[model samples]
Target: MKVGVISDTHGLLRPEALAALEGCALIVHAGDIGKPEVLEALAALAPLRVVRGNNDLALLWAQGLPDVDRFEVQGWQVLLVHDLADVPAHLDQGVQWVITGHSHKPLIERREGCLYLNPGSAGPRRFSLPVTLALIEVGADALVPEIVPLLAANPLKATSR
Candidate 1:
């Protein structure tokens, strides 16, 4: 199974980001989704699970979003949140992956038996950070993660590919 992971869209859902996530089995959004349309766009692609970011709190429509979410993907337990620092001190022992996004920097690492992944900012470019997202492939025994970088989307020619 393949899972598409994205975060910090802020409001814009780049064409590049959507193109990278095509054909995924599931999608995880770590938050800072500035507008509801972002979720609508992702949901159109696949099953999606998302958490609320700190910035999302000011918006009435996002108020119902959860601060944290947990579920299983291809038998791998996963925790979804926006800020790594806000993760609870106690987590389910079965959780094998912690997915977060807040700093807008991409990260993929493993420590003490759990994998930590951040899909980076796919929205407005910040500073010099490259826009990116991650794809997770679930195999019979282990999970494979890959970071995909998105170049600026060309609206006029975005669909030719």
Candidate 2:
């Protein structure tokens, strides 16, 4: 299964981001979603699983925010969390893939037989960092995670004042 992963969209959901995610079997938003409409937009494309970010108010997003989520896709046990620090406590949960977002920097690495992925920040540009996301391909035995750089959503030039 192909799942589109994104996070830190501080209210801006670029057309390019949406276009890049089209036709994915599922979409996972790690956090910092500026508005509920962000989830709504993604749901229109496919089934969505989202976690509450540090900036997201539970009351404001009572219907959408989830602290932690665990699900199986294509035979891979996937765990979703907003912060990486919260991972160690749950590391023993038997999840093959752990996904999180907070720093807005895309990362893909395998440690101790588990895959860790951060789709980066797909929202407004954070400093000079490039807007990014991720694509996860789950197979019968292993999970392949790719850090997808959002070329069209470069915030460096757009945010220059």
lDDT of 1 by residue, 1-161 (tens): 98899999999999989998999989999999999999999999999999989889999999999999999887888999999998777777988889999999988887677888888888899999988888888875788887788884421111000
Steric clash pairs (candidate 2): none
Distance from true location, Cα of 70 in model 2, Å: 1.1
TM-score of 2: 0.88
What alpha-carbon RMSD in Å does predicted model 1 have with respect to the real structure? 6.2
Every candidate's lDDT: 0.87, 0.82
What's the number of clashes in each of the models?
Answer: 0, 0
Candidate 2 per-residue lDDT over residues 45-134, each given as its tens digit? 999999888888654664556788989888777899998987876475678788999999888877777788889999999888878888
Off-target runs (Cα >4 Å) in candidate 2 are 152-161
TM-score per prediction, in order, is 0.91, 0.88
With a 3 Å backbone cut-off (N, CA, C), the pairs that clash in candidate 1 are none
Cα shift from native, residue 49, model 2 (Å) = 0.6
